[model samples]
Target: MEVNNRYITITNHIQGSAKESDFELKVVPLRLSVEPGSSAVILKNLWVSIDPYQLNRMKRYSSSHKTVQPAVRITPGQPIDSPGVARVLVSDDPEFVKDDLVEGFVHWGEYTVVKGGMLRKLDPEIDLPLSYHAGVLGMSGLTAYAGLFEICKAKKGDKVFVSAACGSVGNLVGQYAKLSGCYVVGCAGSRDKVALLKEKLGFDDAFNYKEETDLNSALARYFPDGIDIYFDNVGGEMLEAAVANMNTCGRVAACGAIAEYSEGAKRAAPNMVDVIYKRIKIQGFLAIDHMSLHSDFLSTTTDYIHNGKIKVQEDISSGVESIPSAFIGLFRGDNIGKKIVKIADE
Candidate 1:
C-alpha cells in the first residue's frame, strides 16, 4: 500500500531561537512494504518526542554533530528524525515482524522506513501507554536514570539540586534523587512548574528561577549546607550558581545546556577556582553512551511507575501538524514535563 506521509522539515538552518515559521509540513508518498530480502522496516509513526536538543541539530553548525550520532545536523527539506514510538507495518528484518511495537529513531511524519538497526521491539504485553515509549519510559527516562545514578552517583542523605527541574529529564532526575533518599531541590522557569516539581514530582523543595534576582543567593537559601549533587540542565548562569553553592567533593552531572542552545547565548562559566577548591567532579554525558544501563533503568523505572513511587508528567499534543509548535514551546518553557506529539493512534 502507498500512503501520503505528512512530515515536518526546516526551511533552512536555524542559528538563533527557532520560530514556527522556520518549519514546514511536507507530504510525500510512502510505500508500506519492504523489498524482498531487504532489511528495511516500515513503521506507522505514533508518538514523537519534542525536545530542546533537537534545535541544536537544526543549526548550520553544531558541536552535537561531533558528539552523538543522533545529533547530526538536519538538512533543509529532509524529514526530521526524532526519538519516537511506532507500530511496524511491514518488516524484512527477522527481529521485527508485522504489528510489532517499537521505539527508536523515527521521522516526524505519519510513517517511516528504516533499514534495520536503531529500532527496538517493545514487549507487546507491557501494560503502559504507548506514548510513554516516546518520552518517560524511553529516552527521557534513560537520560535521567543514567545521569543521576551513573554520572552523579546519587546516594542517601545527599543534597541534590536540579536545574530546569520541570523539564523532561530534569523532573525525572529530581524524582529519582528523592527515591534515592536524597534531599532534592529543583528550579523551574514558572511558579506552576515549580509547584509541580514540589507537589507532584516529590521534590523536597522547588523555586521559580524567573522570580529570583540572584541565582547564587537563591541556591544558598535553598541549600544552606551546600549541594552534594548538581544536575545541570539549564547551563549558563544557573550552572555558575550551582557550582558556587556546591559542597566539597560535589558531583555535577551535565546532562544538557538548554540555555546555551540559541545563538550568542552565554556559555556556562562556572568558577574554576570554586570547582578546584571544592573538588567538584563535573562530567558531561549523553544517554546513548550509557546503553549498558538500559535494562536496569527500564526495569527499575517501570517498577517505580507501577508502584506509584514516581509521578509521570507528560504534556502531549495531538497530530503530526503540531510538531513544530510543540518543539518551539520547549525553548519558551511552555511545557511542564516530557513534551510529545501524538501522530497516530495505536
Candidate 2:
C-alpha cells in the first residue's frame, strides 16, 4: 500500500485577475521512499515563498527563447510551485542524510522528491527565524544584492532611484545605496509606504505614485539634476519617465517588471531614443545570471544584519491554502514587504 500525500495544484491559466478558486487542493496515494540509487531526496516542506516572478511561468511564453527549466511545465491540474525551504526526511546521495534541513525547488506540497543540485544545506546555528531563509537571506536577498550592487554599480554620492521602493528588494536596495553614500529616492503605490521608505528605510526622498498625475514631473522634482542610477522594478510608465530623466552616462538595472505581471501589458515601449539622447545604460538582469555571487551575497548580508547596518521586513501568511490570497495581494499592492506563505511552521 502507498502513502497518501496532500498538495496544491493549479486549475487553469488565469488570464485576468487571479482568484483563489483557480487552485485545487488534493490528496493522493504515492510512495514516499527514496533509495540509495535513486539520486533523489525526500523532503518535508517547512516554508514556501510566493514571488512576482512566478506569474511569468503561469502564462504562455510568447518568445522563442527556451524557458528556464524548459522541461518543467506548469499545466492545469499540476502542483503549483516555486522555490521553498524544507527538511530532508530521506536521502540517497552521500552529500545529504536523513533529518538534514534544506532549501530549494520545493513546491506547494508538504513533501517533495528532487535531485541534489536542486537543494542546499541551511545553517542551523544562526538563531534567526528559519522562515527568514525563505526570504531575506534567501532568493529575495540575493535578488536585491545582485540587482542593486552588481547590475547598477552604484557609486558613492551618486543619485539612485528605486521603483516599488517599499518592496523586499527595493527596501534593501535603498538601504544599500545609502550605505554606499548615494542620495536615494523611492516611489511607492501608497502614502504609508512612501512614509516608511523615508522614515524607516532611510531613503533621502520618497513619494506616492498614486498621488502623482505626472510621473515625469514628479521625477523631475525629486531628481532635479537627473538620476545617476535607477534600480527599476515596476516597468511600465515608470521606466519611460525615469529614462526620460536620466543624466549623461546614467546606469539602470532592470530588476523586474512587476507592474506588468498582472496586467501583462507593455506601456513603456523601449525608449532607446532616450538612451541615445542621454547616453544612458539600462540593462535587464536575472539573479540566476550571477549565481556565483550567491555565497558572497549571503555572507555580506549576514554581516550587515549582525552589525545592525541593514534590516529586512516580511509579510508572511500562514498555511498552504493562503497562497492564492497572498499572491493575489501583490497585484493590488496589498503587501507591505516581502510576501511569503508558511506551508508548515515546524
Candidate 3:
C-alpha cells in the first residue's frame, strides 16, 4: 500500500538560534513494500527524540568541532533524521521482519525507509516504556553511563556535580552517582527542575542556576570541598564555575555544550589556570564511541529502573508537527528529562 508520510525538513541553513519557522512539514508518498531480497525495511516511527545536538546539524557546514559536528549536514529541502523508536511495517531484510519493533537513526517523519545500518530489535519481554529506547534506554542513557562511569571515572564518596542536571543524560548521571554512594549535586534552569532533581531523582542537593547571581559561589555552597567529578552538559559559565571549584585531580566529563551551539565564535572561555593548578582531567566523548559498554549500561540501568532504584522523567510532545517546537525547546530549557515527540502508537 502507498501512504502519505509527513516529515519535517529544514527551510534553510540556520545561522543563529533555531526557530519553528526554520522547519517545514512536508508530505511524500511512501511505498509500504520494498523489492524482494532488498536489504531494506519500512519503518513507522513511534517516537522521535528532540536533542540539542541536532541543532548543530541545522547549521551550514564550517569548521569541524569534535563535540558538535552533524552526522549529516541537513539540506534545505530534505527530511532531517534522528535516533528514534520505530516499528517495521514491511521488511526485505532477514534480520528484521514485519511488526518487529526496532530502534535506530530514523527521519522526523511518520514513515521512513531504512536501507542499511545496524538497527537493534527491541525486546518485548523487557517491561518498560518503548519511548525510553529513544531516551534513557537509547543514546541518552548510554551517554550518561559512559560519560559518568567511563569518562569521569566517578567513584563512591566522590563529590559529583552535574550541569543541566535534570536533562536526559544529566538526570541519569546524578542518579547513577548516588547509587554508587557519591554526594551528588545538580544545577538546573528553574525551581521546578531543581525540585525534580532533589526530590524525584534523589540528587543530594539541587540548585537553580538562573536564580544564582554568582555561579562560582553557588558551586562553592554545593560542594564546600570542591567537586571531585563534573559531568558537564551546559558548558560555558557553568563549566568555568565548576572548574574554579574543582578539587585536585578532578575528572571532568564533557558531554555537551548547549550554551555554545548558537553562539558561534562567542563561546564560553573556561579558566585554564584552574585546570593547570588543580591538575584536572577533562575528557569529551561521544556515546557512539563507547558502544562496547552498551551491554553493561543496558543491564545495569534497566535493573535500576525495574528495581525502583532509578527514576526517569520524559517530556513528551504529541504529533509529528510538534517536532520543530520540541527541538527548539531544548535551548530554552523547556524540557525536564528526555524530550521526545510521539508520532504514533504501537
Best by TM-score: 1
Q: What's the true lDDT of residue 92 in model 3? A: 88
Clashes by residue pair, model 1: none
Best by lDDT: 1
How many collisions per candidate? 0, 0, 0
lDDT of each: 0.92, 0.81, 0.89
Q: Using TM-score as the measure, what is the rank order of every candidate, best first?
A: 1, 3, 2
lDDT of 2: 0.81
Task: Estimate candidate 3's alpha-carbon lDDT, on a 0 to 1 scale.
Answer: 0.89
lDDT of 1 by residue, 1-346 (tens): 8899999999999979999889999999887878889999999999999989898999999978887779999999998889999998999998988899999999998998898559998876668899888988899999999999999889999999999898999999999999999999999989899878878888999999989999999999999999999999988999999999999999999989999999999998999999999999999999999999998998898889999998999999999899999999999999989999999888
Give stretches of model 1 more than 4 Å off.
Answer: none
Candidate 2 lDDT over 1-346, as tens digits, reads 3665677777876665667887777777757777658788877788888777766666555231254662244777776667788888777878888888876778777777677556788877666778778888887788888887888788898899999888878888898889889999999999999988888878999999999999999999999989999899988899999988888898889888887766547666657988998888889877777889988988887888888888777888887777778888888888888888888767
Q: List the residue pairs that clash in candidate 3.
A: none
Question: Which residue pairs does candidate 2 place in steric collision?
Answer: none
RMSD, every candidate, angstroms: 0.8, 2.0, 1.6
Selected candidate, larger TM-score, 1 vs 3: 1
